[model samples]
Target: MAIRRQDILAAAQRILSEYGLADLTMRRLAAELDVQPGALYWHVPNKQALLAELADDLLARVPEPSSRRRWDRQLTQLATDLRTTLLGQRDGAEVVSASRASSLDTSHLGKRIVEIVQAGGHTHAHASASRDALLHFVIGYTFDEQSHALMAEHGAAPARFGDSDAAYAAALSVVIAGVRAPTAGRAAPRPAG
Candidate 1:
């Protein structure tokens, strides 16, 4: 049997699910696939590249934003879907965040969010700021949520908060409201003559 790129990805995902990100190292992955560590480079250039690919694969599970929906609704659904998708995999949020910081080509999730906000009649600068805020919020929220869940699962600590789903929705609504603020699209006023 030949070890293909998908095979590597599959093994990496399995490693992630079964052992979390720390155990998803290149050497461990190579061992999981029963190949020399160098063989992985034939398919992926390095650990950072492999992690970026995995992050992209995880996010790809999120459904595309609906055109029929209002832009705010689309933004909300997209953020929720991304959070759900990240929560579905172990250390998924961490992987995506790391990939985002390390590589410019990893995922277009932020870009899509910017487009959604722009469609809502905001300037590019406003839309971009909104996208940054929204992505940071979603990713940071999911990372903390997952970490808390993991800790509670291992008896390290009880879940820190109650009604997380509601909390997330409420916070997202606040962000969307900020995105829709009247001044969001307004340019600086010219000084009076």
Candidate 2:
């Protein structure tokens, strides 16, 4: 019998949830599947391939940005989409950050976000950098959200203040406010004086 690609991904997700990203091993997955490691190879060529597919799976289902909102709000929603998807399973960003542009899903999302940022009047270079910045923000925030292992290792839950969700949303609101089009600040020209 052939092991399916989705089965491989599902098994990896279970393993990741059970043992976190660092403990994910093809051999361990094979054992979990009750098959030889070569069987995994039959479905996935290597660990890098597996990681790419896993990351793709994670990034694939994110919601499309809404057009009726402010540009910054659109981006915030995009960031939230990225964040929530990554947080749905443990160590999702760990897998995603390891593979960039290797999957069509991630590639499409990257292109879409960059396009919107550019349309908002950021220079191509700024848009590129901002895209990376947004990705880092989403990944880092989600990592922190899913990081009980770090707390355990450090012997306590890290001290935090304020309503965390509100704090994050508020901070994002401020940051988005700052990422405005050049025309945003232009006052209407006065009559010739």
Candidate 3:
């Protein structure tokens, strides 16, 4: 049987889920695939490359923005989808966060997010900043969320905010507001009773 890149990635993800990120080394992955470590290197040049691919895979699962929705609503949906995807896998947020400072190609999702904010009347710089802020916020929040889950799994006290949904929504609202605030004449009004 040919040892394919997809097979290696699948095994890596399984290792990540079953044993967490620390246990997902090339040697272990090779053993899981019944291939030699050198053979795995042909598919993924290095551990960082493999992790970048995995992070891209997770980001690919985020739902695309709807063309019919308002820009703010679209941004909201994108942020929510991002958080859900990160929480879907063990240590997924860590995988993504680790790749952020690298030159990996995240243009697919990044382009769409910047487009959404730009459509909301932000300057290009502000749009890019907003997208970065939202992604960073969600990754950090979900990392903590998963950390709490791990703590609970080990019978330790879970550090938690109020309701997860409410907290996320509130924080997301702040991000959206900040993004919208810089538009010259289109600042959203405060909610009234």
**Candidate of highest TM-score:** 1
TM-score per candidate? 0.90, 0.80, 0.89
The TM-score measured for candidate 1 stands at 0.90
Best by lDDT: 1
| Candidate 2 per-residue C-alpha lDDT over 32-148 given as tens digits, one digit per residue, 9 for 90 to 100 | 899999888877888888888888788887888898876677898987778778877778877887776344324777777778888887887767666666676667776776675
Q: Which clashing pairs does model 3 show?
A: none
List, in order, the clash count of every candidate structure: 0, 0, 0
lDDT of 1 by residue, 1-193 (tens): 5679899999999999999998788999999999899878878878899988898899889999899999999999998998999999999999998888854222577778878888888898988888878888999999988888898999998866678788999999998889888476679899999
Q: Which wins on lDDT, candidate 1 or candidate 3?
A: 1
Residue 80 miss distance in model 1 (angstroms): 0.6
Global lDDT of model 1: 0.87
Clashes of 3: 0
Q: Where is the poorest 10-residue window by lDDT in model 2?
A: 99-108
Model 2 misplaced regions, further than 4 Å: 101-106, 148-154, 159-161, 181-193
Candidate 3 per-residue lDDT over residues 56-147, each given as its tens digit: 89989988879899999998999899899999999998888777656422557778888888887778999888877877788889998888
